[model samples]
Target: MDDTSRIGAAPRRAGDDVIQVHARLRSMILDCTLEPGSKVTQAELSRLTDAGRTPLREALRMLQQEGLVKAELNKRITIAAFDLDKLDCTYAYRISIEAAAIRVTASLLSTAEFDELDRTLVDMGEAIERRDRDEFEGPHRRFHQMLVSHVQEGARARMAIDADWAERVRRFVMQGDQHSLARADAEHREILEACRARDGVRASRLLASHLARSAFYVAAQLEPTYDTILTRTALRMVLGDELAQTAK
Candidate 1:
């Protein structure tokens, strides 16, 4: 079906409608097409997605729960801002969860799965060589996901949430420097090699360190962009305040 007809057309099932709307909205947010902290009007969203109010609202609610949208006091909903504090917390939480998941999954990976992961790493290398940012992100995510796929189902779900948060943070970081692109490629290579050796502990440690490095780099880049509330919040939290305050 055409794009217009597809968005307007209702899903075959009620449950599927919610999922489809949520996925589309989430994509817009991650890609910065909707942008952070931008107001979202139900009428406007309905027109944009060509979906009805009910499904749009349902989708917005789901995004809110996922921390991608903020439901304000006056019943207004907007795309959530990139909160450094929350992002920092998420990084910490994810490192713990994903590291554990990867460790467990390493023990369970089959020869075929290992081969697939190796291929994904190869794809990531090519994407980096060509500086294909969009292509790089897909294989980058897949490589990390493969590391944890053999874990318990529940653990994989939790890791997926972590993966989503990481992607958002990566997009933000990419806005500042191309150097991070190279660093990310190198980190993926290290992670894959560790996993291939079945060294769960080493793999987990490397993954955590890799994520921490990315978080630090992004937090550094955000210094000059901090607003008053964010500045104060960073101060109270003793995180990025000094750099933010000095930023011109």
Candidate 2:
């Protein structure tokens, strides 16, 4: 039997191999290691992730479900093209993911986790001060991931499953928008303060607005009209009375 049919014949780590390959592939897809909208073959993936073709194909199938890749007419895989038009919705979705995570897990997070979170934020601040995107990106992602990790394993996994895409987009935006990065850092500090106080409501609201601001800013870089109405509606709901007061 080939590797595919022989997986059951192999040890349990064969299944584990599929998962590891999938994670690496997902990271590559999001980090632009594979390049956006570029074609990738199974052989390429096998070589890249150092897995057998069977597990590589398994990883590819999972990625395809996430909308990160698709089979071409020639049977090659194409990295899913990013639609700039979706910026507003992408922004709003990220807010929802983060807001839900914070609300559900704020009280559950251990004090030590909070300290680690604070340290991560401080690292981000230092990276920002030094103008090091590489440094900032790592801590920034860890901060968000740790924020979600306070919840149940399943909840955290679900929250993080699609995060690679957001990371990729953020890298794109941060590369050219230092002003926005500064604003984001200030917002993050506010968020950390709210979390430190154990005020879930304030933390959630601030997070929504903070995310909305980034979404709108990035969307505005595009046509400014595409997905504007939907994003604004979502943000207002997140902002609640604050949005109305701002309008007046």
Candidate 3:
């Protein structure tokens, strides 16, 4: 078995064991160490996380609900594959929602809140200079989350789901080229400036464009391998069939 399978074979107790296992497995998938379309078994996951079968099963089920895993015939579960069209759709939604959230957040910001955002931006700058992807992603996520969570509690929660989608795209880009990381860092600066200016409208527009640009760049890199039809169809199914129907 491979490292992923090996990691999948560990064990755990209950309560936090279940959450810890889920986070570990999810991190593996997001980092592309697990790869899209990889097969997952509860038995293997139990070994990887050192958790019991019951918790492993529960973790997998939760991942499935989050669109990170898919159940196949015969009870097998596979990591969800990358689909450009679905990614594009997700980018579109993220741009719109997050921009709006930022705008709202900016409108309501206090001195302390602005200072916190500024500090996060500085941390991002340091992370970039150090070329630390791991360090960068944390504060990067927090900065955006703070902006959105200030606007609406639910906004951050919804964006958390979208973050998983973004991670899939990021993993692909990082695997292919390191240059993309610099571009992302630069974009974050622009976002920070807009927020600091307290120009909600401008911030919103910039945020939208920033998100779109990343998707466009990643999609360009994936073009050689991605099937347009397959991506579009998959995204339509995910958005319409799953998310849409579930709300009904």
For model 2, residues 1-248, the per-residue Cα lDDT tens digits are 56688765755543348889888887676656777779877767667777887787788888888788997666589988666556566666666767777977677788898889889978998988998776887888888787667667876676575465566677656754768678778888888888878888778878778766655555666545656666566666666867624732
Mind giving the per-residue lDDT tens digits that candidate 1 earns over 1-248?
Answer: 66787876646643237778788788788767888889867767766677667787788888888888987676567888877777677776766677787788877788998888888878878887887767888888888888888767887887787788778778767656678878877787887778878888778866766776666666666664533333233332322445434422
Per-residue accuracy of model 3 over 160-180 as CA lDDT, tens digit each: 889866876766665567777
Name the lDDT value of residue 175 in candidate 2.
57
| Residue 153 of model 3, lDDT score | 62
lDDT of 1 at 229: 39
What would the TM-scores of all predictions be?
A: 0.68, 0.66, 0.72
Highest TM-score against the true fold, candidate: 3
Give the count of colliding residue pairs in each prediction: 0, 0, 13
Model 1 TM-score, 2 decimals: 0.68
Backbone clash pairs for candidate 2 read none
Q: How accurate is candidate 3 locally (lDDT)?
A: 0.71
Query: lDDT at 219 for candidate 2?
Result: 61
lDDT of 3 at 232: 37
> What Cα-based lDDT does every candidate model obtain?
0.73, 0.73, 0.71
